[model samples]
Target: MAVGGLDLAKYCSSYDFNSNDVKSCSRAVDLTEACNWQKQRDDLEGVYKSADLHSGICLDPKGKDVGGIDDMLGFCRQKFKRTLDVRASDADGKDWRCVMDIDKDVVCIWQYSDKSLTAVQENGLWVCRRPADAASP
Candidate 1:
């Protein structure tokens, strides 16, 4: 399935924090961390506009209503805090990842090394595109 032109199955995975699937949850956390790292690098380099920052929010399945970015960040922060109790400083020091609702029920999280790839928010939805495509009118 695709949303905002993104092929969900090709680049995304889903996770239920309430489920017994520990691995899935862990994967979500790892992806979140990767996304956060990319965002920080982009910010440091001043490569993207402030509006584009929301693209970092993890995509969620439609109708799931997992709450806004803040809620997702809270969940991630709580999870990390539990695991890194001793280094709680590190947990809170970094930015917590988040989720955003989109059409269809799909979870999309990706880590891209290709600087050519970019995520831009349009009509309140995040769309991934190549630099050339994004520059076009």
Candidate 2:
């Protein structure tokens, strides 16, 4: 079967599923789709928005079901060694927060509006500064 532009038959050779090589085999399959990884990350970044419950925080607007916040956190952690303070609001407007030990060097935050989101690049950090107009929390 072909999935995600990869042919399973070609990538999956006959190997003992219980052997130590299983990880290697899985990695080989994962690497085959690595070319799309950057685009996927960028696409996710495009949809990221400020959490409704917090003034200076941002998160995946689509929430956990889509894994957007988790994926972006992983990317930020891996590439920049920084973390984001992510938050969410329940339907009734109660706030739930998730914070990581943000690097002191993180000088920018995500700026989101009703129609758009912008990530600013500063000192190798790719996130927006808190909007000047945002009310303090």
Candidate 3:
């Protein structure tokens, strides 16, 4: 709903989408935004809960650096022992650690050395990238 930047009432007022169809899309948007927010919050909170999380990358279902997203997530359970809910953004070949607000879902991303990362956002989106596991050594 908030992410789509569209509302059913407003969409129906315009003639492009049928009022009935608009409800489905609006609901989809609402669900997506809710899911995204939920996942990201969980992932960050999981990391924050761990004293051991900072030593290496936490490979999560949503933030894999390669492959199509669906396939990426499939590898998640095998490669890492945990699943954390998080939103998706597209990027590869970068790394970060994060200090997160468990309550608000806001994350402050940082590099391995604890310096901040330059957020390479597109439009209004921000993504978290982790160092290549092979490259970390």
Candidate 4:
């Protein structure tokens, strides 16, 4: 199954992240963006254009209607585990470990040497000891 002209066959024969394609093509496309609708529609649309395909909406790997943005996000979350890891260092020499969720949203936070949170994403800015981090702004 191919979504937006992406040969998901290399990723999976089906849309479920449990398929072999997940292991095969996870590096090709951010499975997170391919899965998330609200945050990725424009980006996905660009891929669609490059492929000379226009479906108006992003399709699931299996070519089924994803219904809506919320539904698509939920479906991907339910199907895939956190599939991305990114690391960096802060200006103060603190380490930052960032994990990209199934939805391609980066949950990044500065950590102490032992890996304890020193600052977290809060309303688009990094703040110390904050809860309820918002998506990148």
Q: Which candidate is the best by TM-score?
A: 1
| Model 1: per-residue Cα lDDT at residue 20 | 19
Write out the backbone clash pairs for model 4. 11-21, 12-21
Write model 1 residue lDDT over 1-137, tens digit each, in one string: 11234444333233323221211223233434333343432222111113344333432333222222333454455444433211111222233232222332222224333334555556756565555443322
TM-score of each: 0.22, 0.17, 0.15, 0.18
Determine which window of 10 residues in candidate 1 has minimal summed lDDT: 84-93
User: Whose TM-score is higher: candidate 1's or candidate 3's?
Assistant: 1
* Residue 35 in model 4: lDDT: 38
Better model by TM-score: candidate 3 vs candidate 4: 4
Q: By summed lDDT, which 10 consecutive residues of candidate 4 come out lowest?
A: 103-112
Backbone clash pairs for candidate 2 read 109-128
TM-score of 4: 0.18
| Rank ordering of all candidates by TM-score, starting from the highest | 1, 4, 2, 3
**Candidate 4, residue 25: lDDT:** 21
Order the numbered candidates by lDDT, best leading.
Answer: 1, 4, 2, 3
Give the number of colliding residue pairs in candidate 4: 2
lDDT of 2 by residue, 1-137 (tens): 10012112222222211111211221111211221243454223222235553222222335422322324333323332332332222323433222232222121211122222234445543444444565533
Q: Candidate 1 — which residues are off by over 4 angstroms?
A: 1-114, 133-137
Worst lDDT 10-window in candidate 2: 23-32
